[model samples]
Target: MSDSSTAAEQTYRVVRNDEEQFSIWWAGRALPDGWYPEGTEGSRDECLARIAEVWTDMRPLSLRRRMEEATAG
Candidate 1:
């Protein structure tokens, strides 16, 4: 989808196996549309990497303090 906040309905929920491995998906929620890796399944690293990339691309946090402290006196 568009580069915007992650809505519950548009985020790709990473479901991990009992052993904490990337197993299943709860897509269309934790991510926007068309955000995924090609032929990358059962790969924890890849899944997390994609998640981080997507989250960062969305500016997940609003750290105003960190954003202005250096410039603010």
Candidate 2:
């Protein structure tokens, strides 16, 4: 309802899971299980930019490993 509240809502932190999947979570909130902070925090756009820069591999870690194994055999 207020400008400050809206700004707060827009703040986010980049996070990643065990599968190496990248996402954004609200700053100062409890992260979900299996997700850990990547030490970058900012507005939604900033967090997304960080994810874009780091998450070049869209595939999950397990999926990539499986693909590698399939090709190796």
Highest-scoring model, lDDT: 2
TM-scores for every candidate against the unseen true structure: 0.24, 0.85
Leading candidate by TM-score:
2
Count of clashing residue pairs in every prediction: 9, 0
| Candidate 2 C-alpha RMSD relative to the actual structure | 2.3
Residue pairs clashing, model 2? none
Candidate 1 local lDDT, 1-73, one digit each (tens)? 6434333234334543322223336454353343443333334455567555544433223454456766887
lDDT of 2 by residue, 16-67 (tens): 9999999999988999999999999998889999999999999999999999
Query: How does residue 7 of candidate 1 score in lDDT?
Result: 35
Q: List the residue pairs that clash in candidate 1.
A: 1-33, 10-29, 10-31, 11-29, 11-30, 11-31, 12-29, 12-30, 12-31
- Global lDDT scores for all candidate models: 0.42, 0.94
The per-residue C-alpha lDDT of model 2 at residue 9 equals 70
